[model samples]
Target: MNSVLIIDDDRSVRSLLRSILQKKGFKTRECADGTSGLEETVGYRPDIVLLDLLLPDMHGLEVLDKLQKAPVTRAIPVIVLTGSTDQENRLSALRSGAVDYIEKPFVAEEVTLRVTTQLRIHDLIKSLQTAVQGLEDDLKAAGTIQRALVPSEVPAGIEDEIRWIYLPSSSVGGDIFDIIPLNDHSYLVYVLDVSGHGVNAALISVMVHRFIEDFRSSRPGDREPFSLKEFMRSLDRNFQFERFETYMTATCVIADLQKGEIEVSNAGNPFPLLLERKYTQRLDRDNNGAIGFGMVKGSTSVHKISEETRLFLFTDGIVDVRTCEGTRLGEKTIADLAESTRHMELDDAFSKYQALLGESLPGAQTSFEDDVTFVAIQF
Candidate 1:
């Protein structure tokens, strides 16, 4: 039988929990307060912990914190028990690392269901971890290839400072950003996000990078300006016959600083938010439609890109990130952050925006749901 540790200040509550769990064929260990609960958790190493929020020696949250910090107890699932029955408490408990939170006056069946679900999830995680560990060598090689594809430094003659933040939701993700300079006066800045996660998505990202490089090489002299429409048409034609089932959404912005103008284009990508000294606006697209690549056989309509403006391009991972309360951190929040930090340097502005998002959603883990990548450039 799986072992469980029940921590509550009240003797009656502990006894009731012990009876229920024992009847369900689980070995139960009881602790009278938070202090002893923490010690027992480390010593006994229970598969699950039933912890009460209010305790005599210390608060349940504090006990949770300690348990999470202790290497021996961190992986064990904890379910918080509270009398408050408030949404805030529930959200806080979940964010603090509790697998689930149960309000007082709980049903036996509900508790059993939650406990069983968590245990199953824990087992699944362990299995996945073992499988991944077996592929450690392959993963290392893949990491090397991925890093090589990323530009170590922004291209020369690009006056604007470029900064990027990338977090792959899995071991690998499809979000990619690149800043390639065609010449001293012209540059191509693009951010692309593939529709999925993992190895397949990452492989697609590499293919996109290779295609972009080939497209750049095919273009003629730097003296004559490159046409954004012509480039998109060529790209659409090149991949029109490919057999790949996956499709990619991209936002490509071409800028000619010498002419003080830019041309913005998108293919099913989130609108690139522009942050000016005084205001913020999203670059316009054609009917708000997505531009499809890879297996999709369609021509993407190119829009006029604006110049003398800073461009902020990102994947849905960043824009649609959620808080523990299930509140979305939408495009508006990003726009506000960019506008508020417009006067600051590019790197500083990026850091401030990331920090603000982190503060708004507090948790031990600081990662978005999907692969997140952002690139900002000022002309």
Candidate 2:
């Protein structure tokens, strides 16, 4: 049953409203003054309130202010009751969050209809608020699980200085990186980026993460260095045209610790950068499209690294930023930044790169505020 609160100083007016309200099947509570009315509004927690503009000790507008300010009573729908035709009181009551106004000479049928209308509206708002809260809670939980999936410590047998960053624009994002050891000598360092944001994109990223983990476990620990070309092919075949769209791009690097060799196959991602105190080497010549309905037969390249090498593998979001003049932060700029910061700490390098992008562009901040996931592996 819907509950109604009636606040008025007049004894006869309160009696009349109570009779009218009870006849309409509303459970009513009455208060003869503003003080007791506020107490009843909070204590009883009615679905709606009918407040009188003229009270014995205080005005109706003051009562509305007190009710609206208190959290416990703030949400209750208020319909101001007035005997005087004061436009000021009506305006003040409405401005203070009253839902509707009823004149002192209000008809019983009109009062019932207005109260019923406000109650229906109140219920609808409550329903929407509940749904929004549920969605927020679910996204928060998904983000927590996705962060847990991000690889932190390096694989076994590799004492490399592994530094990585994953920053999502929202509760969760589509950028994900993982390091899975395919035996003690070879490990797969892969970064996958789905083209989009929110739960749908995050879900796809998580699925890709799980798929790669399964592939890592499928191989024998002592197996020959995993073929770079074959790995890309397997990924292309797994996410077939029939299933995933071609927008999910990846950069998968397989490093052989025993041979001091690293091979990278692109599935539409930023090329890996080899940085050292001496020089920088940017790998691959061709840019490959994402793996989806059609496989572009992406370019695969191999390189040998020394002990002083620091390799960076990242999503394109970090380097795809644009400036106020419509200039995109291309491969050359990013390559130069990586080379200069080669001697600096890994975390500092990443921060400086992002800061430079922000300082260069006007719309760059919002457009490039995408999910950035990158791994820096130093030997």
Best by TM-score: 2
Write the residue-wise lDDT of candidate 2 on 53-165 in tens digits. Answer: 88898988889999889999888999998756688889888998999998868798989999999999999999999999999999999999998998657756777678776
lDDT of 1 by residue, 1-379 (tens): 8888999988888888888788899899999998889989988999999999888998888899899888889999999998765677667778989999877776888778888899999999989998888787676577568767877788777877678777777667788878888877778887777778878878878887898888787775575556666666555555442445566677777777666766777666677887655567776545223334433333334333344467888878887778656888788888877888787777788898767657655567655678888788766
Question: What TM-score should be assigned to candidate 1?
Answer: 0.60
The alpha-carbon lDDT assigned to residue 27 of candidate 1 equals 94
List candidate 2 segments past 4 Å from native. 155-157, 321-333, 351-369
Clash count (model 2, backbone only): 2
lDDT of all the models against the reference? 0.76, 0.81
- Count of clashes, each model: 6, 2
Clashing pairs in 1: 262-305, 263-305, 264-305, 267-291, 268-290, 268-291
Output candidate 2 Cα RMSD. 3.1
- TM-score, candidate number 2: 0.89
- Using all chains and alpha carbons, the TM-scores for the candidates as numbered come to 0.60, 0.89
Model 1 alpha-carbon drift over 4 Å, by segment = 1-131, 223-225, 238-242, 293-308, 360-366
